[model samples]
Target: MKIKEAILGFMREQAYKPMDMQELSKIFDINKEEYKTFKKAIKSMEKEGVIVRNRNDKFGLPERMGLVSGKLQVHSRGYGFLIPDEEERQDVFIPSSFMNGAMNGDKVIAKVLKEDVKGKKCEGEIIRIIDRANKTILGVYEDSKNFGFVVAEDKRIQYDIFIPRQKKGDAKTGDMVIVEITQWPEKKRNPEGEIVDILGKKGEKGIDILAIIKKFALPEEFPDKVEKFAANIEEEISKGEYKRRVDLRDVRMVTIDGEDAKDLDDAVSIERLPNGKYKLGVHIADVTHYVRENNPLDKEALKRATSVYLIDRVIPMLPRKLSNGICSLNPKVDRLTLSCIMTIDGSGKVVDHEIVESVIKTSERMTYTDVTKILRDNDEELIKKYDYLVDDFKAMEELFEILNHKRLQRGAIDFNFEESKIILDELGKPVDIKPYERAVANRIIEEFMLVANETVAEHMFWTKTPFVYRIHEEPNEEKLHHFREFIYNLGYVMKWSNEVHPRALQDILEKVKGKKEETVVSTLLLRSMMQAKYAPQCVGHFGLAARYYCHFTSPIRRYPDLQIHRIIKEFINGGLTEERIKNLTSIVEYSSRQSSEMERIAQEAEREVDDLKKAEYMSERIGEEYEGIISSVTSFGMFVELPNTIEGLVHISDLNGDYFIYDERHLALIGERTKMMYRLGDSVKIKVTKVDIDNREIYFRLTEEDHEDEELEIHDDIKESLKSGIYEEKVMAIETGYHDEVE
Candidate 1:
């Protein structure tokens, strides 16, 4: 209360004047009885350094203001923000010109310059770069006469690295390569580097994978010694090893994954108990049994953290022999596994569970497409063609429907998304792009795995065992509020409050089901939420709406899962001491950070591949008219995604026969001469104008009615509202007519 009074009092005194106890009492307009109390407040303020006390019994500004430290988050524009890791509310702002060699994700110290706004965080300038996350640069090589330059793939790098000729080694021009940063010049904008390794040519099969690995500073290849060590691991499952664990070899366990998936990580089995509860078994590949702790293979796995799933291939954390062979839960083979067996009631609530080391013989391997057909179609001839899987598929389908309903009743959100799959030819070119199918059998497997993971997490938490948890914290309150405002503008109401649960957002998603703006709203809602990350601390998962969750189902692909398997095994065997668990507390946190970085790199590489494929697909379709929905809006243009999953930008000039204006806040492009508008999610027909593969850009134009087609022009008011210079540059249209007779 006193601090508030001081701030208000200081604001009133604009001139250079100091306040004494007598003057402060007059400002409060207090009686003589409270004069002594007001004097004590002034003395307290002086002691606290809120105001400096001079020898004349007057107070003035202190020598120093507020200051704080946080990790620097540098954007592509060169400006940065210091996001305090803990309780500091206001982020320190560092202008682009003040960022002293601070790269993105770097830890830095900031000196406060001034407060940004009333009650907001203070703005500051980055004075020192305490640390850098950019140790290695992944770029395309450009060879020169005496030296070479590495053009960074990351747009945020802002400058090309000047590589020394001697350090170029075998790197060739246009090769995707990794360069080590040797020194950063004090005055120059660019940093000097040396080419450490040549990855491959751009667009090559493995180049995207290599680029992502280098981007995250993750290792691409397994070391020679580690590979040798993994190669020596026998595929044989001995009887002695099986005797000490649960033997689920006789149970009808199966693995359901994508047709292209080779590294089978988990298998599942289910049975109804006498009490009407289901006993679900999640059998995960026991990589720890093959690769011992602290060995070369284990060490490598820890460093890599998790498997990178690119568009076409997977860069596994462990060597191929371990991930794809010895530890893979392939069908018809006896494999060692860390099993989480849970007994759940009809409501999908777990009543009992156990983490057991086991040997499982997978009965069959199923694909999502095959199972989807069995469940959706009743064609007698088709069923006869796949008679072997008909019965098992039906059983899996029934179980999935039951569990799904149970999950829904328990307030779980069903965010069924359309995932894209690339079909490649022998030459590695994308022949077709299709939506990935998620069948009932896949859902069955997923449900069983979720139950197992939750059971394991709950057990560990209750036992007070130190372990890694997959945590998804709440979203930023301001972001959620903005999302609510955006949704309200789109004629959809969203419920939000400081005390709202994750389930509340799920409720909004359910209400928007089948709406025209579902995709846009869903995408925006996901952006408003925080990302899930690995941590040693326990926090509820917002996306899944689960109190306890961990990645225990994909050990072959995720290193953290493998580590969890080892920890569970240690605890089950009663071999872990207090010190061992204590060490795991820190180990989990480190692995979580590394795993998150790997995931980010993988996502970037996946996007690159998707963009390339989209460009290729749109190349032949130029000038063909197709209906599409506006997916995004920008100052330059509106992006529309065709039904084929290809998105192209429609320049604002082409919005109508007239000029257009961009409403930045509302994200709409209005016609200048006309009042017509093209906002996000609006449906319109667009013809493919151009496809630039090198730049990963596709351009489109609105089809007009001149002689052969029907079209509408922008409204006059909308056209008149447009600002000049909105379309300063002219966009060229692509020639779509085929030249069969030109030869």
Candidate 2:
């Protein structure tokens, strides 16, 4: 008899309330002889401690099954991994057949079907889809002669939407649209949907932006009701309201930002005391004053969680009237603000701190360019125009310098690189791409904001008040090892062990500050570091080297700041007791998730805009030759980025000048006949062979005659592996589904 039959037989005989043998037999599927065998098998099950064959012989799942959860890591192959959500357990296996259509980022409930297989692996299936992470999808409308479909933009989304021609409405063939999935066919490969909104023609500027927004499901504008509410806010500060807050109307505070900045969220004032300490005031526009919790405007802001910043525009979390008008810390305007006043000694340590609600009048409104000029050259005329800022500016400069020194001493890692700033012509075409330079004024503002954020976070943590904190967990040791090896291939060495602290990485950065491979090394270091995220748990910020850190300065653009302000107020008003804090903790976690999603969407939008600009710029330059470096390598081809920052692909077939194999360990494409090699970070010359803006793809071809050899020196192990064909085999194994089977 089989184990199933024996178990059913034992259950019928010994169970106090005998389990229905028919039901048990059907569930396990067994015959009378098999039942006798399963009855004996129960002894083995009890010995293995898998279950307690009750007096009734019926069994129930262990109580711990309820706690089983993990991150839903969906694979490109439609299968996925069950990475333990607690971050402590080793990931479990979830076969493709058991996925049940769950995608990446979804939270799921899993049950342990079996324990460790030889203590090496755990296997499970998703029993419940606790939360579906995706709601909106971006796709191009495919309208044929009589039928239509929405071809999904996301490659992982295997199913397409069958759209009726009558419901297609204005969306034509190839027009991008935001389609909401109405029904998912249980047995069919396609979902049912209708065009919710027609986004414009494909590859058009407006449609490109909308595509980016839809890709992330990020909002592009405020709803009409929210906008109307913002427009109706009282613009003037009342005396009665002013009396309720601390008065700082006479303080020589000022707002400093980019020249085009409209949403001035924060202003600062710094002065020296006779006791040899500095008094620094950080006054942020109190967004909570105008938008209360659970209100329409507040709910909208909470949903956004953060502002999306593109190269040419900003999709603000709050309406313009709130972010740029009444709540903005504009110059000469009396604005209500929540202030963090700190008395600090020369050593950059806060000696005393106080948080207050205040009404502040700005003494000056200055741009970064103007302030930098005044500080760099002491432009007497510009300084004289803002007389009240003369002393305050000097104090600000001193404080920033001191803070910077302190930050360096405390192991704060500084990763600085040239960021591309596109200069557009009148027609919105990119005319020039320049590196955005950081100035003294930028550093000054950053230092002040950092300290203020740190102060607020520390206070919140100390009080045990629930609030959203900006946290960057330590990097993975295994990933850091790979990064170390990659950097070593570039002729640089870092003394990094599995247990090395981030400060060691910081020191390595300092050593490679101005070398030829600085940019590449920095890029690898970033890839090694963990991404910063918002959470209710207080983990010290790794990059800033701060014991506490939160987003408290930019309430105008960041919803987390506004939420933090509200939490702080509640704590001060004695409303944040243990129960209230518990409730707020869940809210913080949700906000963090929303904030992360919002940022991912914003980044996609920015990348789309950049890709569109690159395509537009390169469309006219097809077949034009340009100097480039091999930026990336794959089995099929290599990607080259020109000095202009436009990346194009060199397909494997184009390298037909010689038969080549991808050398994985050496990060190169090797020719079988000529031994010619192209490695990552190797400078080369290529020509634009094709440009496809519709696909957001660019193609390049290596010149047949151009050969500039600069061998990228590598470790002997990597070199030997590449020469012995071991590296190629490994690469092929990874690319050809070998790793997937093991995973």
Candidate 3:
């Protein structure tokens, strides 16, 4: 048995008796020579929360003392929660007073003050900080007379960093800076830090996004050696290399992407089989071919893990020399690819598939707009423009529908939420905002990629290879139960059992289709699902409803895909030697963890940039009224989301009617005296009241003008109906459920 387990067993057997170091040594048969080793083991156990030392210098099991170890997630309001590492455990709420200098993202050991029982929240107090999540913070520097401070851009930090004048470096007032903590906070004091970098002035062009990138510690530029190495790589495929790979240069394939996309990493080709089945080929750019493992370029790509797509720019995983040039599957250029060619039956079942290294030449570059016009709108102009590939496009669309139908039948949950597209001018100022529509063309590509990823992953799995798989575990029971209650209160019934499936949530979403509450419902459901991440273990993806899945496409943009490509090549060349397998076991494990972490950082940075741009866009429309829906309700106020996806808070202070109390059960703000309620999904007219650019926050006020105008319009419609002698007939129709149909 492990030393910690033995210690715990011994303590439990003693029935609440605490043992000192000397006593433990004797009980464990330790001599003087082993005393130091025993003491070290005990100390490690204490730090890990498996055991704890009392004031009397005696050790005991933490479970008996009601202690837990978890990572701390601090809120902007100064309070935090201890999320346990154990998946089954509930989070423990830690009030600010009980924090004891614990910062956000710290791994800490807490003593449970109140145990969670029968739906009650668990409460705890931090007793020890095991590790600090970060040593530096990104914030805006402020100049004082002798000493300055940095106001953290990350609201969860809660405390401004104190920078002594001598430690301020070259940072000026209002400059976005990175601060390295020199000394942690003590009783009622701020943490002392020194400026490490001065990003730029706050309002400068590109500075906002730069600040987010710094905050997430995203690598902005490639190292000199890496760039030089990538530049020296052979741009053209050699004759010898062409002989090694399968030649698919004559295949009629097209790269489908956004109009402005520069990195064309994936292309698709489809044809009808002799047996009336469909042959679909997904060709992904063979980035691993040029960027070998352990090289300078590969190291940088591994560090990035995934490309970050910000509002105005992209921080690519690979440099432009490769990502946009040789590795990009641009039309009329010969490019190497790792292709997944599959033959699908009429029922969308993959009857056979082949994963091969191949050389292909893309025939054309098709944009989502043109494809949508051809397939969805049936525009004759676009159809004729791409006349040569008309039959191929139709075949792809047919296969896409069949695959989509099969996925839906197996309980794949599709959250069709609209994403915001913010347009910026040359000055880097927001010019417009709208929903980025996903047309049928986009879905077709997505479906094809999904199948390809799944096929490659399953193949590697059955081969008993060490590889990274995208895993999304099932949702926590407690969170799901809360979601069930909220949906039930909204008059939607989702069948709940001991285990919840994606289909149950899908059914609820289908019921809410076309309702005013659709977006909010889908958003909440998404929140209830676990985040998908890269892992060495094959934990099935709950969202995709796939038993095996890996990111095998877009090697130029994602490290996991590139890593798998190398593994696939190794498998094809020969078999995995014992030595290679041993090495890959460690490499794949570390890559999976690092890629997941970097991917999260990239996503957060992207969100921060998008939020900043959105706030900037809304700043110009101050005081303008817009129709929106109540997206969320909290103790402070409710957040309203406009049709264009700009969300702003409507503070409770601006309610202007009565003292409102938060109704957590119903997700609303209830007026105490008037019994008025503003609930989630309710349509509300709001005027932009305030915009804090530095904080990237927008505020709104509930307006009565739009509501009054809506009421007047309804009254006029009623009056016109009465004058036309249809009022009685309309009332009769409402009694017959015709009003429901109109709604």
Candidate 4:
């Protein structure tokens, strides 16, 4: 073993004590000839923060001394949290005063000062810095007579990059620029940097998104090698290859997606079987077949992980030639696919299934709007135009309802939050922000994909093969307890015995569906749940209430789907050899982690762009008045969301009548002397005061306020949910679907 691993392994012992260099050298039997090399290794580790040397001339791991090593995630208000590198460790909170010059996204060693008493995280202070994530800052250039500064777009980075006159390059005031840090920040001093690249003037067309792209460090273009390799791949299927694959060209499958969607990854085909079961076929484009393992195209796809769908643009994981051409299941064209054909019964149970490499010719490309109009509105024109597909659309809707009911019966938690879709003009300026509505047509596609993922995941899991699974573990007990208390104050009860189940949460969501407090309660409940991630193990998905689930539908867009496609093909062709199994075990382990991290970055970038565009939209209407609902109550302000799903903050200082104090337990703010309480779901009126496009923040001034609670009427579901727990006896005594088993 390397000296670093040996050192850590030795220090991990429960009985081992801190020892001096001489003592460690003796324990590892280090001879005099090799002592210099050993000493250098130890010093290097100490500098990198893997190990620490104490003032007492002793060496040990930092955790042994109550020091947590993790990445520091800072807040806009200067406070931060240390998300530990080790598993099962709670995040350590660091107050602003103890930041010790650590900026956002810095890797550091923090000393735990206090364990949390009534909260979910612990308190700590940064004691040492290991690595800095922001080697370059992307922001707007602020000019000065001699030296300039770059004000970062990320508010969490409180410090501005100081630039010397000579290093300003051609960047001018208000121009978005990338500054390479020349010096790190010290006590009460900002980091110094030099302007490297000037993007364009702030507020210029496309400059906003370009700056965001740099901030998130998203890969903008595929390497030429990857592009060349993708271009060189023949789009046509070889005759020899088609002979070995299942021929499903006459299956009457169709690709259903948005009108603007270019890369259609999955197609669905359904038929009534003679055995009184529904045969559902989910055919995903065979991306892995063309992008071979360890090749240039495959490497780039793995690095990007998932396609990033932004409001105005899409940062695809694969090149357009592959993702939108050969690998896309376009209508009336032959495409290779990894098909999961399932035999589902009336109860939405998959009784039989078959997964194979298949060649299919999709009959039509159906858009969500057209399908919804035909099935839901009974649009005579659309129905008549697609007369032959009316029966198929009705069948899809029927099967979707049955499958959705089965999922709900199994206690799946469906969060009904309104997702905002920002509409941009021809010049990339936000025209409006509207909630994206999901109709029966959308649900049909979703249900089909969900069932296919479960089927593939379960089949591979039972075979004991190595594959990437999408798993959502249960929430933390402390967070759940806190959530239970908050809901109890809101006149709702979480029914669970021994542990919390998704049913207990879903019951609450169903009760508050259209109520005024729906958004607040739903947001809180979703926050209390753990975030799902890609894993090598099938720990079950809590949100879907699914025992087995994997992302197997979008290989053209998601790397994990492509990864499992390769594994499933291998397992189906023949059993995995011992050597292949070993190789795949390592591959999946690394692939899952990288894919998860990239997915997170992609999500954050997308949200940032949304916020930026929203701010721009609000900037155009700074003085307009609008009615809104209080969505969140923080210490410094209250967030009011307009009907269009745009949220703006009402700073506490802007409250006209009285000083408001935050009520932590009730999630409200009370006017101290006036006795006026502003809590979540309260109706209010506000006028836009200001907008900071760079920070993506909107400031609103309250014009009118409503003291009465809007959630006055209670639903019957809430009443039924109030008396849900019948597990007075024990675990088995509970007659709730929370404990129901999956097929």
Order the candidates by TM-score, highest first — what do you get? 4, 3, 2, 1
Rank the models by lDDT, top first. 4, 3, 2, 1
Residues 1-743, candidate 1: write the lDDT tens digits. 56447544663465647667677667668798877777777666544434555568776653332444456765555566776544335566666676767777676666678876763446677665556768888899999999899888776676689988998989999999888889863445678898888878987875654666567665667889998988787777787998898888998877888788889988877776787777778888888897678899888887777777766667788888877788878889898988888777766667788888888999878776666766786757657876865776665566667777776766666776667777777666777887666666577788777777788888878867777788888776756776777677665676655565766777778877887677666766776777788887888787777889988888877877887887788877876788887787778777877787666666666677678677877787889998888877766788887766778999776665667666643456655555457776678788889998755789999876421332444433334434444332223221110110010
Clashes of 4: 0
Tens digits of lDDT, candidate 2, 40-63: 555554443333433465553222
Q: Which residue pairs in model 2 clash with each other? A: 5-35, 6-38, 6-39, 7-38, 15-56, 16-56
lDDT of each: 0.72, 0.75, 0.85, 0.86
RMSD of each: 11.5, 8.7, 7.7, 6.9
Candidate 3: tens digits of C-alpha lDDT, residues 297-340: 99899988999998778899999999889998889989999999
Clashes of 1: 16
Task: State every prediction's TM-score relative to the real structure.
Answer: 0.81, 0.81, 0.87, 0.91
Cα lDDT tens digits, model 4, 153-179, are 888888999999999999999999999
Worst window of 10 by summed lDDT in candidate 4: 734-743
Q: Between candidates 3 and 4, which one is better according to lDDT?
A: 4
Instruction: Give every collision pair in model 3.
Output: none
Of 1 and 4, the candidate ahead on TM-score is 4
Candidate 1 lDDT (Cα, 0 to 1): 0.72
